[model samples]
Target: MEAESREAGPSAALMSAIVTEHFVLQSAAGTTVSEALGRSSLYLSALSSSLIALGFASQTPGLLLPFAAAALPTVFVLGVFTMVRLVGTGVQNVLYLSSISRIRGYYRTLDPEAARYFARWGAGEGETDDALGSLAVQGGPMAGLFTAASMIAIINGVLAGVCLALLTYYVVTDHHLPAALAVGLFAAATSLTVFFRYQHRRYLKVQQ
Candidate 1:
């Protein structure tokens, strides 16, 4: 009985440690999500306020150009910073989830009977593979575009195009509306493509 108790002691301590670690990872994941949402809210609020101010400025005749010249660039830059941090938080959350999944795998090993309870939890044949496979099927290829970070990116891209259009109208093309529109559309498309590609690469890096 003494020898049996000695063997059990270490196993019990290890399981306790595992449980604590699992809880910590879950908490960290939640924190990352919260941070992402908060940052997104901040950015969106700023963008909306700037737009409203611009709307008012447009009514003042000569104030429109000067106001947009200052406001659009500032808001666009803020959007860039916000989008980048959002992507970081998203990646961090994924990593935390991956760690939690690994810990759950340990739980299954300790109690084979408990595996049934975890079957729906994305354990799959291995720790991460099946979970990712299931996610891919459910989310599809365009799922990344639906994230908060992607939403910000799209808005930022449009802002960039608008800025370029204004510049073209006032400076480059000398108030040619058609030329400004063409340039703006091209800028918007290019910006979106670059943002989407960057996001895809970041996610792929996380998976690797």
Candidate 2:
């Protein structure tokens, strides 16, 4: 009974996110909102799974207590808040781009003073302007944000899959739960450290 109830946690979170996304998309305009909904739905699913896993893992006599207090809101806030920020940033960028007449014109060579201001030493704004300016002008930020959200979704799904595999091992060969914990922790660590940071870190590295 505890296991069965705990299993419902992720499912509830998933349904909540999907409904929320659907409503948000209905009111928002442009591709950013659509992309955001897509990304949110994916992240929500992953977090929901994690929520369910954690809840079930805690399978005490009263599983719903843990899920209500801990699991559901954690997944909801993490997924929704990030999506909201990304979408807001995307909309602001679109508005900024709309202000300028010629994106190409903005590429006018960066003055030495401006280079010092931006600390873009040896970096060419004539080329980078279009790319980076997209943060304020084009959909580049949205695209990049989507990529990050997608990577997170993939990471969670992979972790869940690893857990399933470990469970299979335990059932098939009677291995202890330690095997599952080790594999699950390894995947969690990699997901948190690698996939979460990969894009942002790589971007900074490239800039430097």
Candidate 3:
């Protein structure tokens, strides 16, 4: 009996350690999500306030151009910062969840009978089994575009387009509205494409 206890002791201690690590990872994952939401909210709030101020500026003659020139660039930079941090937090959360899933797999190994109670970790190894994963698979490539980070990217892209349009109107195109519009649209589309590509590359790196 004493020999049996000694042999079991290491296994029990290992299991305990694994369980503790699982809990820590779960908490950390939650924190990453919270941080992502917080950062997004901050960016959106700033955007909203900037738009309101611009609206007021628009009502005043001569103030619109100067105010927009000052505000838009600042807002765009803030959006960039926010989007980067959000992506980081998002990736961090995924990694944490993956670790937790792996720990759950270990748990299943220890208690095969309890396997039925644990949720499937993913569609396959390395893939997350969460709602995001489901959306990505079912919704296809466009599904990846629906994330908070993407939303910010789109908004920032539009802001970039607007900035470029304004510059074209005031300087490049000599106030030619059509030319400005075309330039703006091009800028916005290019910015969005670049942002999406960057995000895809980051995720691919994470997967690797």
TM-score of each predicted structure versus truth? 0.87, 0.35, 0.87
Q: What is the C-alpha RMSD of each candidate to the true structure, in Å?
A: 3.1, 20.2, 3.0
Model 1 scores a TM of 0.87
- The per-residue C-alpha lDDT of model 3 at residue 41 equals 91
Model 1, position 190, has a per-residue lDDT of 95
For model 3, which pairs clash? none
Candidate 2: segments with Cα more than 4 A from true spot = 1-33, 42-130, 133-147, 154-158, 161-169, 172-175, 188-208
Best by lDDT: 1
Better of 1 and 2 by TM-score: 1
**Per-residue alpha-carbon lDDT of model 2 for 1-208, expressed as tens digits?**
8798765444668556655654544344345556666776666686778767766766676554444445544554565456445535444433433333122232222243443333321123433344344443222223344553544545454544455445545554477666666666665566544443544443443233
Q: In what order do the candidates fall by lDDT, top score first?
A: 1, 3, 2
lDDT of 1 by residue, 49-153 (tens): 999999999999799999999999999889889988988887677778777778766666655586776553443454444335434422234546767799899
Model 3 over residues 161-207: C-alpha lDDT tens digits? 99999989987978899999999999999988888887777665656
* Candidate 2: pairs in clash: 97-137
The parts of candidate 3 lying over 4 Å away from their true place are 1-10, 127-143
lDDT of each: 0.79, 0.48, 0.79
